[model samples]
Target: MEKSPTTHVEYDSSNAHSNGGDAITRVPTQGKDAVVGTVRLLLGNETVLLPTPSPDPKDPLNLPAWRKWSILILISVFGCSCVILASGLGPIFSVIRADYPGQELKANDLMVYPTLFMGIGNVLAMPITAVIGRRPIILLSMVTLVVSSIWCQHSGSLGSHIAGRNVMALAAGQSEALLPMMIQEIFFLHERGRKLAWFVFLENFLVGIFFFTSNYMVSAWGWRGWYAFFAAFNGLILLFSIFLLLETLFIRPDDASTGQVHLTLNDVGKVDEEGANELVFRVTTKDKDFLEPEKYGVRTWRTDLRLWRKIDNWAQVSYFYLDFLKGIVHPIFFWLLLLNGAYLGLYIYQASTFATILMSPPFSFKFNSLGYVQGAQILCCLVFLPLLGYAGDHLIRFLSKRNGGVYKPEYRLPSLALPAIAGVIGAFMYGQTAAHPEKYHWLGVALNYNIIFFAFLGANQVALTYAVDSFPLKAGPLLVVVCAGRGFISFGIGYAVLPSIQAIGYDGSMNVVGTICAVLAVAAIPMYYFGPTFRKLGQNYYGFGASKEHANGGSGH
Candidate 1:
């Protein structure tokens, strides 16, 4: 028989906690009252905090809001800087090619190899981060970025330059995994969408702004100057990281006591009630903070800068590996990879080909003025950043409230609609403009560029945030799949774009590309509809822990 809403369970509290660190299961019982007890919400608290913070002041989740934001701001800026180094070369390829005269280096090689290596690097580095800690790996990557920048600046041949860029790209790749995990570890479930937006903005908007500004840098001091700038900037970030970045890998010993809950009602027995054959009651739990703050000593600045901490959970890594395997077959993972990959592929295709199209034949855009074309991207980013970041949070809060205070990850899916529409328009328009340059003005492609960037940035934020929200504990493995998948997917697209352009012409190619991406985007509708069922299928196996039944409870009221 299906358990009624009033189903109740009883357990021996002393026996349940006799062996510390194990969760107490509340078995359902038949009771007459329809009362359901849930995890204790702080009295009068409207929203339940997720992955509940411990009494320890040192827990990353317990840090002051200002401190958390400062760390996020610093890391995000450095991450965006790495992106600039990877992409800055896109607009200045001619200058780079000239340095290696008589070599058969193509623009696609410059674009493809680095992007491929970034993904490879991200996959390879994730397990190490899981075993070690985010601070050391992040700092190490920053140092490597600085060194690689110098190598690119001084390289004498095309091979050496490509090699340097690939190395730097490898360092940049770690951010894809680190950023989201760090945000998740430190911020509340309610705050993740907005915080992750910082990453998307830096990755998309700020990087787009760089495409415009980099041409001027190359014009004044040549291509080498661009590498020189990264070397200096990355060096500065490395110093700051050493002093400021705290280790976020902390273990919670009492997992069962934390706030996160999974509500499953199963009838184990029956009890008599007044005027009723049996009484059915439901088990409920509440998450609460430590009653006394002084019980845990405050964290010191010295402790904050520690490079490593002991993590006792050996099975955690194995669980991550399992999640990684499961994520490979997960429907949500595939949907996000396809949606994000398509936009990323399109963005890279546009960047790699922008110069070639405008600098040739009828349009003949001047070398000095070519960078301004990317200004369209900057404009689009500025307009959409607030919408995706703040407005997104507003929408989530409203939806969560409407859903009887239970927050579902699906609430975030509607935001995908705006980007999907923009992506279709951008892809087709850009393709048509490139194919028929004689008929359309350059402004047509510029508008397309603007819209496409908006789509890419929007997709990036939604895909990553949704993945993390779906499986917070498995963020390391889940991100490994998405980030690594995104990298390699973009690589394939980058390699194929030029040939596709030549073989089918831009119109035929883009029409196909746009249709495919729009379809991927449209798939979000069904995903939004069926997301919980899909999450429910994998949540238990993928390790959402005690709250596995509450797959949709990744957000707050």
Candidate 2:
């Protein structure tokens, strides 16, 4: 018997006199109405080959419980590779500055250029992924990244390296869109807050470790080693993906509308009393007009890799723009962006410049010595990672129980306030320290560094979970937006950091950055107070209401 979904079977015991006593068996799918096997097992009459599955989700072998952990472990590995890839390039910024020759270019611009391209890459990926798919997008992106890494290693001019970095952004940067998207696919309604925490930690904090390690590598093996190292690790990641990572692309979003049932009548199974031999009856549905599975993906030589090239221009014109418009209108989406930019952007902004800042006078730090300052972010992240992981989950679980097993996206926001407050304070302190490099400075600088990154770890975790909760089904596209925002904010800050520091002398400019952050944070209050309500209200208003409908049931939850 072929195994597929929505199948049924029946049992008939009508014939008995011709032979000895005969037994019958019947099995029905969850929604189907029919009998399966004998009502009583002890009678030794009927047995089911593959028992009918219950509608209530009770199959131990195929149940989500058994498979979820397996997927989580895999998702964690994939997510961590993004972490390693994302952070590993950081420490090499200075070496890159030395090797490349763009005279007028600021030292921090080395970090910023790639980040700027990374944001652009994110914008490009959303449409490409929607048209292609996640797996193909990931595979192609990895190859792009791998080639770019090699290009970077051998480049002569600053322009060549920048080109390579742009290619890297085109490929490797998709992880920003991919990680949370994958999480939505595998986890259940309740597991998102906790499951995505592992992902957020890997994406945000672990990158710091990679940054530190890259610095160490540069110290031992020189600047070229940074690219060599990136390529080597990237190759390993590709191998891990090829051998172990399953294809998560081309799979349709889980939706009830795409599922259906068919009706059929068939004979029941019978068992002979003489030797206990059993006969079975089955019914099947034949498809009349089978859909031509759309060929999706960029074409490649590998036969299996060849793509069906139909452009999804309508989806492109509609998806992100609608998402963008709705995002602007629905306070939740915008709020998520602000919190994301504020918290995640804070650490990214600070860390990218830390090396340049410390390497200069006052700190009087050397090449590799500047990396020691990264300890602040790594250590601070270690402290808060576990806290952020459980807090969102606990609050959601608590609210779900109170609401009679129902969960709301808004429930995830309470503990988030803690990090939000802590982050602003951290940024404020760091700005004050920079404002007066000559005065109340050393501890102020250290504390400023510590607090911003400290709050960053937690804020990032909560904010991402909230986004997933609010727009579970569209987690992919929404994440693309988040990635864009992060790339822009990070690149913008990193690009201008040295110049700003040089021109304004820390405090004056930091005060500016700090002020921008404070306003965004304050403006986000409505998102906190009225987020869930607004998500619902915008469903009918915007033509793209699928995201809103999912939040209640279909969305990532």
Candidate 3:
């Protein structure tokens, strides 16, 4: 490896940039064709690493494989715990309504309201996380989750219990935005799909498993015991996070590009004759050398345990909310907002009503055995886990190879096809079967319900992953748009679904839902074909693909 002469550089930790959009905008581009920036392939035209890693061992991107997976598992478990806490009320809904007597509280208010706040909570979390760090936000939310669970358990009034659940939903909302953002921070582009699938799989799988088991818990110890179970689970997660969860935000020195660093095929050939791949990409700046892990110092376990990280540019905090609004309007973001919301709303509506429909029909399902319906979803997830996990990354890699090693975010869009198709078919089957329980066996409802969940799992992984891939640095704000949009939209759907079912009947309501899914499905055709052009048009409008000069005084990259 070659060495560059070292020179002292003044550090300015103060905020200089008005918005941190340049973090992604500063990546060098080839042209309009390169809105996502082009990757200079290896000698064999292999896919180049995106958001290139620094030499610092302390960089999350450079962490060992075991360490990265460990953190991912911990975060996934935390997210799963939140899911369990948020949805436990559903299985025990009958018991709660019986206790409340003649109160105006209904199933939607109990379930939909908290679900809505989860979106509200997601929006609230981003600004704070943007300012402080992800670790602190996780710990803070976990504390809220624990307290709210206890409050929900011991509530003296119907209103108070509902309020407690809303608070718990708010706390649980952090998992929606932060978990995906953290996964993006830790994993490379090639690995994101699979890792994200791992997180979603755990969440969806646990939701299914919890529904299956929650009734038994309620039967043995009452609905309050459900709350107690999650409170303890959350408490344990809080402990694990305090010691094992490290901060993933890695800030480069002021001289380096805030955008991802990459080396071309030519640049690789310029390295020393030893052919050391580790030292090949280190030719960064005039004064400072890249790959200097020693300068950053060794990160001891104590350092990893730190909750708050220094933000070199606090001015970036001011832009977090504004970027969220901007992201809401960005073409791709808006599309995903709708796509995610429609699927999530459909799923929530089904889960909320699945029990009521089954237990009250001519088919007459036993309350104790209602969980058997969710077993189909669990099996679907188990089958789809490996498929959804690896398929997106694999498909894009193949597409990238065929594109002469230039990867486009559009490659990720194609995978949305599965969910879109599933939505249309599943809604039709579920709606028709649910409406006529006498003609169709209850198994029809269960099997189609499984199909809807399959769509939910696929849509979630693809939509979230594509958005992050499109706007890598701006993931936090973009996810706020995605998570909050889905939450609010789904909340509205949850609030209205039962009324719609009552007014129009299950078949008619599902026909409307199936039509909406069809429209979204059709929209994907254009999105896959013209997504890059749309992205190019919106890049400047959204503060993406801009030059480094746009970074102004630098937002610490």
Candidate 4:
């Protein structure tokens, strides 16, 4: 007979029946009683408890709350600064154009190539990080960012400027992939959504601030001033990272003795003993801290700041390569890549086109005034940050309770609804305003931009949380996919936006893009309904949850 979803079988070698190890036994348990005698495999909710942490003091999960948040805050600053450098160039394109008037490269192309390189650079940088550790790679990337910024400041031609930006993109790739992994390393599943929200908020807030500020910097001191400012800013972050950031790549072995249990056929009132049989029982227990207490005399500050820490020579480069390939081919990951790419493309399209639209004909917004307009996005993000971050975390807890404590990744999907609606309205209004700026007031455009940004930020947080929760073991490779896919898509859209506007007129282009956004946003429906089945399929075919040994009685690893 086929086993039910709630049924699992465990073979007990120590208490096997004496039939020369050939015969088998059967056990049956029902309802709440089914989980009582088995090794507490699942939590009170039917969700599998994944990769139970070791009882080691130095385990990342064992760290104090304040310590974890401190590291997260520092990393967030580093990530936010990288995003500013990547995007700050967009608003100052006019200044760049004025300087290199006769060159073949347009200001938009400068934006396009660097964005593309950021994605490509992630592919190259992530595997090395997996081997060398997150801290060293991040420090190296910061140093590269500072060096590249200096190059951009000194560049006299379009070629040299683009070259400098591309080099920066190569270094900035670390933040895109590393930040999410850092969150996964430190926080529990329940805390991930809220933490991810904070990370996403920092990124959006910085993007808005820099884009707004770039206009003023360009108008006041010229574009070189922008590069100088970023170089100094990144240098400070590098110093902080060197002194404060600890290496989070500690390996904790699964402890089967404390972590697992065995049950017999007679334990649950059902027994069929032909000779030797497998009895599988599940026990549920309250969550407890598995980390050991920190040692009193150890000096962690010296250890954290060590520049030449030993690399993991045992890390197989080929294994990471295969993992990356697997992430690329994974069905759910592929879907996430498309969704992330499209959302980023839409946001970049709006931002890249914003200054051009308002600086012309009807509005003729002064360079200094661009900050106020972009401030609309910042305002919306700030408003929704709590709603999306804190509320979304609680929503998952509530939904999990409703489902009898069996948390499926699909719980993350419902939060996407409000964002989808916002996107549709924002796209339509922005498109209409752009098509007829004289007909609709500029406030209409600003309001629509606010709505779109709010939705986009929310969607990003939800989607990323879902991705990490669904495949925590593969977080590194999965983020690589997300970074690369989103980068290429954003580049394509940024490159095409000007020509598209000229060809279709602003209204037609916006309508087309809006429709696509709506479709993509609604795509979550099928995922919500079918996600459990898809996860099961992945488990069967590719061993998706194999790394989560705690969930399966600490045997797989």
Candidate 5:
């Protein structure tokens, strides 16, 4: 009996020769077309034409730029609001403690548990979002957030507060993963980096804004007033989302028979019947039943009002779960997961330790003054985010043009350098200042905090963009690993940070964490050099190629 042919085209490095090496070799597979896309060399870098947008005007990719931005901005706001509720609690832990006198409500119990659950919830939420639709899950998550906020505001005991916070965290996790996946769905390859930066900016900046204001809100009406404000704010966002957000999920087709075709750079050499270069190739249908919607129509009041409508693709639950697990184990995904986890853990440690340092002897900041420090970090983000976003997108464009219009995911890795250097400098300054608070002015500490925030934002935007560029088809599942891994790891580190700081003074703790962050940031160096090889390996081993749905004009959702 003969062995079955592999689905992927293998590129064996050992078999290269002087004459244009066999970078891609196709093997015949039964029931599928033999015309696999070609991977060409452009300026010594591997390149291929990405999947073209479907002709259907209703396809998310084919939507007008203005319309896409509108939707993205709304989603960003909703997501940012959810994140603010989660992180803003850190600044108000004292108020909460005072509210429930004699109750054992540690930050770990109230804040860390919710943080951990936010990640844990994604394991359940993402697979559902993958099956159901993005719009439904988002709206539902917002409703849950609203209710949880209300419950938290009325909590009379430690257990009730923990439960409410856990629910709220679960709701927030939906946005954390879904926003990036939505960006991948709506934006083109060249556009994702900057858009991701916008998403990160909104989340981090809003967290600062909310934290800054919570001080006043608590002072004016007490801690419950803070939860009430969140409840009202979340409720408004939920209403706005229902009316404004439309379902971005579409079923794209794979074959040319239904007016869709997949293409490769190799086809640039072939001619069509009209004598033009046949740059696009046609593939057979992998799933003929999947069809693109006719129009990219905006959701009406009636459509949006149907809160309980069943999503059509819910039967793919098993596949969604399996895909998420498989992505977690893939080398590229694993590397990104670890990198994200380390960076987030370090940031969380900084936030947790910041409160301890400022609330202590040298600079006994009043309740109102507690949030002013974050203002500097927010300002820092405001200045650097746009520049970094522009630089990241421009870097890829410049490198692609330099390499003869061929773009590789590794091009994004250089942006990592800014964050790596900034993190080291910021950590040293922050640690030294914190070690001798009386010697170094508080403003210097604030400047170091801003530096760290700037680096964190830059690193996050680059990593997310790189992940999507590397595996556009598998983005949904890949994000599950990124979001969940970061959430859990950060929670663990956050829980321990206070204790660690107590054990070893500020300088010792900062040195340990800063060293870890610097090391992880530097790993991007090796990734930039070897990333393409890993992508090729994933293609062969995990079918990292564009899915039939994505290639054939079906939704990659």
Candidate 6:
């Protein structure tokens, strides 16, 4: 073995991995294709997270400055566009009703079918992704979306439109779940906030843009034209991205190009048992090799013979799955679920009710066509776009640095409280305006959309990102459950909104929404203040300690 000038441990290929005997350090392969930070060398194969300094000229890990940002914005925009389009059906419901004409149509059902398709699609897409691989799935899904868009252009009957949406939703979920994992690989933690900003910015903008598409096409060219436009746009995306968007699945560290740090491969490596766990004993080294798990003589603990028996590929997958499943009951996820449910409910209500709300007397906004009113609500949604997009992300970065470089998921919340209050105000204004139809017409258009979803747009980002940051490896399954809950809960809310308005009266309905939002706002306290404590209490895999403590036999694991 060779000695180094400083305290750094010496490395020799001969003695590097002795019998997989002592994997002493926690190798931070936190996610598949996810690169979070650096690794440290310790007592023969020991694992511990050693936060390194930001890229200096001499550091090998310094990312490519010029191209990284450019690639990030481009990727984020594409990802956001795909996501926003999934919800685009909201702004065009009247067109759908008129065109399709269901026997018993309801607002909630409208939201349910499309997002249901998205939910079902997401539920199925993961294994398909694992089996088929990311590239083929992406290209094929895009093709489905493109074909659906074209079919929608010709859709005169209601049934055909629903079919088209099903196809589109199925394909769209790929981009939503897959892109962020790819983004995390190329960027550093310090710049992650900015990467997320671009992602959210485009997401909010595209959602607004999808609504306005109906304004121009519905009355002038008819509903079919709307399909043609998006189909054509989707085609453009497919063609442009085919070569520009490289397959980001697997890239070896040694094979990487110059100027990029290749040392962080463990963070991005896909976990499997085949070769990664293969042990090579070091007989020549003089230093005491860390004892292999096999020596413990516990049947479950063995690094050689069954080398990594308890920590093989299945273990990795099972461990991550359990971690994600357990997150839902955690106070953070439970509270986040409440926020998400409220936001989605509000979003569905605003989107579906826009047609009625805009036309009420105060605004007296009689459109030459119904699409005009949807466009107006969409415009109002756009008003909060910039603020919602950047505020939380900006705050996350500031607080991250203030915490002496240790980033907590809770840091994503400083700007979150204000939006909750805004949601309450929006609901209150909308309800009272609807309740007093003749007197409060003017303010209703702006205020009635309390579910304009600005709070949702921000909160969803914060919650999901918090989950991802806290439980890096298990984030996939946690999000899967969260997304499933979001879709299911949204359906219930969508079904009830119109009826609630009818039964409760507009003012009463909004008052209910305001109260829910207020409670969620308050609930945010326990999560922010006691989140770390609870995380520690549970030995959860949803945070840094999760990997260390929850590797074997926890409640769910």
Backbone clashes (count) for model 6: 16
Task: Give the Å error, residue 176, model 3.
Answer: 1.0
Task: Give the range where candidate 2 is weakest over 10 consecutive residues by summed lDDT.
Answer: 34-43
TM-score of 2: 0.72
Per-residue lDDT of 233-260 in model 1, one digit per residue for the tens? Answer: 8888888878778877654322222333
Candidate 3 minimal-lDDT segment of 10 residues: 17-26
Residues 1-557, model 5: lDDT tens digits: 12123212111112211111122222122122221222121322322223434434455665667778877878878877777777656677777776666663363577677668888878887767655667788888888988998998898778888889888988888766777878767765656778787777766677677778878888898888888888888888877777677667655433211122322233356454445532233122121212224332443457545554355455455655666677788877777777777777766767666765777778787768878887566686686667777778888878777766556788888988877788778888888888899988775566777677777677667767777667666666667778787788878878887687779877887788788888877788888888877887766777655553332111363
Backbone clashes for every candidate come to: 21, 17, 0, 6, 10, 16
Per-residue lDDT of model 4, residues 5-97, tens digit only: 333323222322212121112223222322111122234444323333434455565667887888888888788777777765556676677
- lDDT of model 1 at position 517: 90
Could you arrange the candidates by TM-score from highest to lowest? 3, 1, 4, 5, 2, 6
Return the TM-score for candidate 4, rounded to 2 decimals.
0.83
lDDT of each residue in 45-122, candidate 3, tens digit only: 333444555555677876778888888888888887777777545556777787888774453477778778898898
Question: TM-score of every model?
Answer: 0.84, 0.72, 0.87, 0.83, 0.82, 0.71
lDDT of 6 by residue, 193-263 (tens): 45665665555555555555556666677767766777777777767556444433322221011111112
C-alpha lDDT values of all predictions: 0.69, 0.53, 0.70, 0.66, 0.66, 0.52
| Candidate 2 ranges beyond 4 A from true positions | 1-90, 100-107, 203-205, 249-321, 437-443, 547-557
**Candidate 1, lDDT over the whole model:** 0.69
Task: Tell me how far the alpha carbon of residue 360 in candidate 5 is from the true structure, in angstroms, after superposition.
Answer: 2.1
Work out candidate 1's RMSD over C-alphas: 7.1
Position 484, candidate 2: lDDT? 70
Regions more than 4 Å wrong, model 5: 1-51, 101-105, 253-315, 546-557
